[model samples]
Structures are given as structure tokens and as C-alpha cells.
Target chain A: MVVAVAEESRGADHARPWIDQAKSDYWQLIDTEHRLEDLYNLVNVPQAIWIDEKGTIVRPPETAGSTDHFRRMDLKTRTLLPKDQEERLAARQAYVDAVRAWVTSGKHALSANAVRANLPRITPEMAESRARFRLGVWLRANGRAAEGDRQMAEASRLYPDSWSMWRQAADLDEVGKASSPAFWKRVQALGDKPYYPPPKF
Target chain B: MTKILTPTAEHDVAARDGLWMSPADAERVTGWTLKPEGMCRAEACVPLPASAVGTNEVDLAAFWARLGGPVIASDERDVWALGAPADERNATLEGLAAPDFTLPDVNGVPRSLSQLRGKKVFLATWASW
Candidate 1:
């Protein structure tokens, strides 16, 4: 099954279009508050976590954006975004091919130990940041907007490398905010670097 | 400022900031009231350090720790999480049984992860930005 966690504070309302267009045959979840982000330590978009039938996490969370979306990005779309289209498309296509091999292989794919080795390590700093992020979400949901914003800012400060965390809470009701600007600048700074670590095939 | 009065102390505090508050509000939040001696809840009372209390605000970091709760704040010292002692974050990673959560579906019905326990789940998080 598929759980489409819409990383929007506004809940499912913010993620309706993508879901409607997909016409997916699997379960689609709307993670309006980003519980999965905090739960699974999502640092960016298009990350997926695979759970086996016995409730075992054979594959941990990793960048899993669709290769088709990038493959079909026409000239108009290419200029609209800041990306090295050729390089990115190659990496994404390679990733798509690898995941297909793993998923289609199923029980014969890899041993539990091999998949476990691919999981990302949660450092002390990231752990604390995750806690603070979760708290920020909880506080915002519990009628503490100002406090929640402060916590969200802390989460960003503690883990500045995560675009997902920063952009998720960016775009304030007030225009010209710091969050959006910071996120954009970082993306520009990471011109050729791999924003996401290599996923486990 | 929240006005709170308990059997032993009475004061006001900015309850939303998690910074300083009256002894009563502190007790309201953590169930531990401030008294002439220290913080107390129900029958048990613990003596608070004289340095812990300030002219107006109490040291929440020290106080939260004394209650045996794990206190985590953002790098700015503005936001804090003070509920679970260890956060049990490692448990989620170690066990891998997708953490339980509830969110509104397309039709606005609240759906939980527990409902899909018996099945293999492919969870993916997306964004507009």
C-alpha cells in the first residue's frame, strides 16, 4: 500500500490535487501535520519507507521522487526550476531502475541485514531536532501559535541542512519572511551537490 | 498573564511562552505547585532551590528536569518539548512498525495508521514547494 503524506500544515486540503491526479490504486495518506516527517525523520520531499508484510521495515526512508515526472519535464518546466536537468534525470532514472529491482524482487530482494545496513543513522543533533520539531507541531495544533513558531525556528536552526523541515514551515501569512528566503538561498548554494544522500537500491 | 491561586502560593504568568508563570500555573501545567518551601503536588512536596526562582520568572529548564521529564528546546532557547523523558525516537527506528498516527483523509474523515497494521505499507511524503 502507499501512504502519500502531504507535508502541509494545512492537512489534506493542501495535497488534494496531486492525489486526485495520480489515481493511485494503493492507500494514499494525507499527512497534513507532517507526523510522518517527525515519525520517520523525513528531511526532504519524495521520501519513502518500505514496510514488509510482517510489519518489518525492510527498507528505511530515502529519496524516492518519481523518474517519470523528471523525464517528462519539458523545456518550459526546465527554465522555471533551478536544476541540472541532465544530471538529475540520470540519477533519478538510475534510482527508479534500482527501486524497481528491489521491489519486484520482493522476498528474494535482499536479506534483512542488508536492508538494515542501508538505514540512515540518527545522530544526536538530528534526534533533538526531531523532538523539537514534533513539539512545534504539537504546540501549533494545541493553540500555541507563537510558541510553536519559535520551536519550529529552533528545529530549523538545529538542523539547517534539511530543506523539508525549513520549507514545510516557511511561507508565513506575512509576506517576505525569513524562512522562504533562507530555503531558496540554500538551494542555490547547493548548486551541484547532492541535496539528498544516495538511496538504498 | 494567567492568574492562578493554589493552597500554598498565588501568582500570574505568561502561560503560552513556556518561560515564567505563577506557581499555580506551573502546577497546572506540571501538576507541581510552588510553596514557601518548594514545589508540591498532592501529598508530596519537594523543596525548590532558592536560586531557581527569579524576581518574576522561574527557571523552567531546571524545574522541568527536577520533575524527571526530558526537556528539549530549539537552539534559540525559545521552543521546548517537555513530555516524554527519552522521546522513544529510537524505538520507532528500531522496531520499524510504522509509528501510529491519525490524519484527515480526502473526505475529511480521521484515519489512523493502526487500521493498516496487518498490511505492507508504502509510505511516501510529498510537498507543494
Candidate 2:
């Protein structure tokens, strides 16, 4: 089953259109609050975690997009796009190729130790940021917009590298639009950072 | 009806008819569950006093405060915001298991990651933006 962990604020209303249009058979769960970021240690979208049947996470969260994702446009337009586009794409393909290898190799895939070592590095600061983000989401969800903004801003400040958290927090200020110009500016600033930590194969 | 809010889900828990869903709702709102020991998310567990659980309800404020995660309550006592426990979250990072959580589908029916244990889940989090 393909599980889709959407942002905390968007429920089925944001996702149902795409699924309905495709007539998808798989499960597309909606996250009303955006809790998946903390649990999965996700900082951005199109990231994935590979878990074996034993309920153990084989591959930690990392940027994994189809090569086609980058083929269409130049990174110059998509300011949020990672700077190391080709290098990241190669890493994504390597990870995909590794997945194919794992599907065939099963328990014998590459080196288990290497996979185990691939878990995303979560520092104490990250944990605190996640907790702050959760509180921010909850505060905003409960009609306390100002408090929510304060907390979300703190979370974003704690981890400026995570565009997801930053973007989510920025969305709180918009009236009707999806994002404000400030969000794009933030993305432009993040254009040079290790936006998506290069995938590990 | 108590409204439990989380980053991914929200639940209006009615008075229990047979099974008490407060803990389930709590876990849905936060990644922690009320086990026999206490509120548990993964390898870590926070022990709650006997008073925290009533016959068919859980005190969200009490539970939240006890968990040692930042929690703020509204004046009306209807809404509560829960923060993730720092130590438990750190343990989750250390253990490397995605914390289990149940969320509703587009139709508002509940689904959990644990139920799909044997299947390969390509969980992707996206938004309109």
C-alpha cells in the first residue's frame, strides 16, 4: 500500500481531487494537522522512508524523486529546487536502483549495516523544533493564530534548512493565497543550502 | 464531545458506548498512546497516575501536562494543543521506527500505518502549495 503523508493542515479537501481524477486504488490518507514530519523526520516533500516487512525502517527519510521531476525545467525558475540538481538526481536514481536490487536481493540486499547507518540524523535541536512545530500547528488549528505563528516561527528559526517547516509556518500568514512573496524569498535563500540531503545509496 | 487536535488528524470523541476511544483519540492527536503502563509512543513510555483515566475518558490537559511536552489550553477547556515529548521523540529517532499513527481517509474513515505492517508503504507528504 502506498501511504501518502500530507501536511498537517490539509485534509482530504486538498488531496481528493487528484486521487479522484486518477481513480486511485491505493490509500491516500489526509493529515489534518501535519504530524508526519516529526514521526518520519521529514524536512521536505517527495521524501520517503523504506521499511521492511519486519516493521524496521530500512532506509531513513531522504529526497527521492523521479529523474523526470528535474528533467522538465531549469533550476533557475524553481528557486526552491536544490542546487545540486544533477548530483541529487543521480543519488535518487542510485537509491531507486538500490531499491530494485533490494526487491530482488531481499534480506541479502547490499550491507544491512550500511542501511542501518542511514537513519536520518536527528539532533536534540531537531526534536525540540518538531515539538515546537506540533505546538504551533495545534495552536493555529485551535483558533489561536498569533500564538501559533509565534511557535511556528520559532520552529522555522530552529531549523532554517527545512523548507517544509518554513513553508508551512509561512502559510499561516497568508489570507487566501497558498504562499506569500516572503515564502518564495525564503526558498530563494535556501537555494544554496543542502536543501535535500543527497540521497544515500 | 471533546475535540482532540493533532498535526495530522482531529477527532470528536463522543461518550464511550463500549470501548473507550480517548487513548486512541489521544494517540491520533499525538503519536502517543495510553497503554497499561502509561502514554507510550515507541521505546519510551510516560507513566500516568490512575486518576488521569476515568471510566471512559482521559483528561487531555492532565495527560498533556504529565507528558512533559509543552501544552496550552484554551480558556473554554474545549481545545488543547499537545507537543511531542522530547525524550520519547529522541528515542524514536534512536530506535528508527516511524511512530505509528492513525488518520482518516478523504472520507473521514480511520486508517493506521501499523495495520499495513507487511506491505511496502511509499508515504509521501504533500500540500497544494
Candidate 3:
């Protein structure tokens, strides 16, 4: 189950062409309201959860095959250096191997206790930020764009970790700010912190 | 009229004195209904504080906070968002049940997580951005 967390209809429409090109057989859904953020505490794209036959969450959200290597890539050419590309591919391959092993024999599934331990802690400020984000989306949809923008800014201020919340407002229109100079600035701001914390395998 | 935003829906109802809505509107805004004993949804009921209940309206902020949820209102007081508590949202983690959601596929057809029951799911989220 692959879901595109595009908070607005225009964003979803923009992805339609590429989704159509994929020609994949799996379920591809669109979440225009960003429901997964509130429901699962997802903070970034390419995050994944593993569910078993009985609907139990065998694994909590984790960065699935994504790395921060792009930050070091050449922006003008939009390409990673060969060595970095190799490292990125190997990391992604390892994640894919784990997924395959788990799907094949349920070999890598975490125990329920482990799953609980892996779940993200939901703080009061994070919850309030989500509420503010919702209100911002509503305000934007209801002809109050400036108020909505302010609401979203406050939401980002309340929970700085949620880039998903930040990006929705920053990239509300066509040209995306997901990879703008501002985004890179924020990334560079994380001097000692890892951008994508490695999954606990 | 005050607009209350829930996870699933947006409700416009008459409000007074800080998010007090009629019992019927409260139920509509939130799934929980105000009863003689307390506010209830499904089989769960939490007794409301006396001050939270008025002659004809329930104090939404008070009752929501009582349920462990958080309530936030716009500066102008025209819009509010009632958020589910961390406890309720994380219940799926503690209980080991994956939260089920329904979203539209690329073709605009609605699909639900429960529909994929009886199979292993690698639920992944991506962004067009």
C-alpha cells in the first residue's frame, strides 16, 4: 500500500502523470488531507510501516530506503557523485532485502513489544501542531489564505521536526520548496544530527 | 457560527462562551454524544464536569480536554480544531492493531487498508514534492 501524502488536490493531480507511467499492480493511493501524519506520527516521505495478516503493526514507521546523500549531490546536474550513488544504492538494497525477507517468511517481523518500542513518541506540542496544521488547511480552503499561512507557520514553530508540516505550506503552489535553498539551509542547520536516522534493524 | 475541525470532518455549528455547542451539534462535531451520564462514543463514556455542561450546550473545549484530546481555536474564534489525544492515537501501537484508513487511489476510487486484510502489507508513504 503506497500512499502519496499530497495535502492538496493540485499536488495529487501533479503526480497523476508519473503514477500512470509506473504501470504498477500495487495499490497507490492519495492522501489529500495528510491523515497519516496524525494517525501514524509520520514526519517524512518514504517512511514505511509493516502490517501482518491480522492487521497488527509488525513494524512502526521508519525511513525506507531514503538517505540524506542527496544533500551532497550536485544540484545543477541533479546527480550524485558515483561513490555516493553506490553507497546510496547499497543502503537501499539492504532495506529492500529486509522487506523481501519479511514478506517471504515473516522472518524479519518485529515482536509486538518491539513494535511499541519503535513507535514515535507523540508529545503535547506535536499534537497541538497537528491541530494547527489542520486548521491551516481548513483556512486555506475556506478563502483565508493569509490566516492559513500564519497558522501553518505557527504549526511548524511548535514542532520543528515535522518537515511534512513545513513543506505542505511552503510548497502549497506548483513550484515546490521541498528542495529549495531554504530546505538546504535547514538541512545544513542540522550540523551534528543525522538527517535520516538509520532504521533499527 | 463556529467551524470545528475534526480528523474526518469539518462541522459548522452555533457556539457560545468559548466553544459551547448544543448537544446535537457536539455529537455531530465529534462522534461522542452527550448523554444523561456523560459524553459517549460507542461503549466508552466519560462523565463531563458540571461546568462543562450547560442548559442546552456542552463546553466542547472542556469535554475534549477531559477526554484527553487537545482543542485549539483561531485568534478570531471563528475556527477551531479538536485533535485526538496521543493516548488514543497511539492506542494502535500499544494494542498492535494497525490503524485503518481509506484513501482514494490515483483513479479516484476509494480504497481502505482493511480491504487488504489477510495479506502482508508494506505500507509506504511518499510525497509528490
Candidate 4:
């Protein structure tokens, strides 16, 4: 089964014929808008759900195509230096390699025990943090900029070491829609942390 | 003993808190009815606040708030979130079955999900946003 994640803003006008071609080629095409709800089931982009012929999901959500961009040696070798950049780069590389291994092996490739061994168990607090981050996204989409920032801040607080959370906060701050110097400063502070630098700017 | 109240899909209450939905809206959007006294729509049962459930009305605020939804208010023309509230649900999307909708396509042609059932339906949605 081939699942195509399309941007919600552009429906199937651009994707219909290609999907049709895939169908003619004997592929079962399931197209969906890359929605936050999908993220709830699967995190990261280019994710795929391998459903068996009976329609049962054989594989739970996992990141599909592409390697992590931050892991390249070129990025690590770049000139303008932050002191903790190397460590961050190494961690990113590890994450990328892990994802690559998972993709190549599918479920059998990586034993369930091994997968569980590497994964950080989702605690209630962590789950709540993820929910808050989603709420932030929903609020931003609904035009509640300030509320979104507040929710993002809560998420950052709950998961202070998460680069994704910090990066999201920084992105919202940089957008300047919720213009507050203090908020931007908080974003910068999150970047200054050794393990989790704020995403570039 | 506190009786656990369940909100079914049949209760047609306006979701004042922007979380619990009216039966009509839920059915229209999700192709499921809120019933079973616990937000039961089809096979799903979402437990709700007992005090809020009534024969004709649902306490939209209490119900949706429990589901991590904050009630939104609208001015004459625009609606906005009331405040920042933490979400309790998973950020991941639920793999619920998509309800069949029979709406007009862009050219004013009506289409239904039943018409496309046997074939692999590549459904996509668009908004002007």
C-alpha cells in the first residue's frame, strides 16, 4: 500500500494523476493531508504505515524517507562555531543512524525488544508535553498566536531538553506575530543550553 | 457512589467549550452519532461528565474541557481561543475510519463515499487558508 502525505492547502489537483498512475501500476494509494492528528499516530515526515492485506497496520508509525540533515560532517565542519555544536551533531547523527536502521529492517530488522530498549518510554508528563505542543499548533492554526505561545512555553517547560520543543518555541518567537522581547530571550536561552541548542536562529 | 456520566453522540448540544460536539455536527463531520451516554459514536465510547448529561442538553463546557479542549468564544464575526490550556490527548492522529461524506465537488457535482468504496479511494481535502 502506498500512502502519500499531501499538503492540506493543495488537495489532489497536483497529486490525482500521479496517484492514478500508481493505481494502474497496481499500487494501493491512500492519500491524506499531513494533519496534526496523523502526527499523533506518527511523528516526523515521510512516515508510512505498512498495513497487511487484511487492513491491519503491520507497522506502527515510524519515520520513513530521508536522513537527518544535521548529522552531515559538512554541518559539523561549518565555520561559525557554537561550543556545543559538535555534541549536538553527534547526537543527531546517532538519531539518523537509528532511523536508517529501522527503515532498512522494518519490524523484523529491529527486534521489538531492541526497539523498546532504545526508546524513551512515554511517561504521563511526556505525553502531556506532546499534547501541549499539539495544542500550540492548533492554536496557531486557529489564529490564537498568544495562546499558542503560552502553550508552547508550557511544553518547553515540561520537556526542557527537547530540541524540537525548544525549536518550536524559537520559531514562534521569531515569527514576531507574538512580539515580545522576553519571549525571544527565553527562546535564545533554550538555545544556549548545552544539549539542546535553539534551532538555527 | 458517583455515577459516571457518558455523553452519547445523539445529544445535540453546542460545544460551548469547543470540545464536546453536538450530535448533528458530529454526525455530519464524522459520520457517527454521539450516543451511549458516554459520547458513543458507532463503536467508540468517550466517557463524559455525568452532571453535564441531560436528555436534551449537554454541558459542552465540562465535557470538552475534560477532553483537553478549551471553549472558544466568538465576537460578532470572529472566534478565538479563550486561553492557553494543556492538551491531554496524544499529539498523534487517530486512525479512525473516515466517514463517508456526500458533498458537491468543485464543479457542483455530488459524490458519496459509497460510490468509491470498492476502489482504493485517494481522498484529499483542501482549504483556502
- In candidate 3, which residue ranges exceed 4 Å CA deviation? A1-11
* Top candidate when judged by DockQ against the true structure: 3
The model with the greater TM-score, 1 or 3, is 3
lDDT by residue for model 3 over A117-199, one digit each (tens)? 88898887888888888888888877888888898888889889888877777876336686788888998898878778777
Better of 1 and 2 by lDDT: 2
Q: Which tens-of-lDDT digit does each residue in B1-129 have in candidate 3? A: 888888777888999877988899988888789998999999999998798998988998999998778798887998999987877887756788888888788778888889888988898887777
Docking class of 1: acceptable
Q: Please give, for residues A39-144, the per-residue lDDT of candidate 2 as tens digits.
A: 7667777677776665666767777653333332454676325655666567667766766666556632324456557655665567567766766677676678
How far does residue A94 in candidate 2 sit from its true spot (Å)? 5.6
Show the lowest summed lDDT stretch of 10 residues, model 4 chain B.
B1-10
TM-score of chain A of each: 0.73, 0.74, 0.91, 0.44
User: In terms of DockQ, which candidate is stronger, 1 or 2?
Assistant: 2
Show what share of the native A-B interface contacts model 2 retains: 0.55
Predictions' DockQ, in order:
0.29, 0.36, 0.67, 0.11
Top candidate on lDDT is: 3
lDDT of 1: 0.62
TM-score against truth, every candidate = 0.64, 0.68, 0.93, 0.44
TM-scores of chain B, in order: 0.48, 0.50, 0.89, 0.39
Best by TM-score: 3
User: What does DockQ come to for candidate 1?
Assistant: 0.29
Looking at candidate 3, what is the lDDT of residue B28? 82
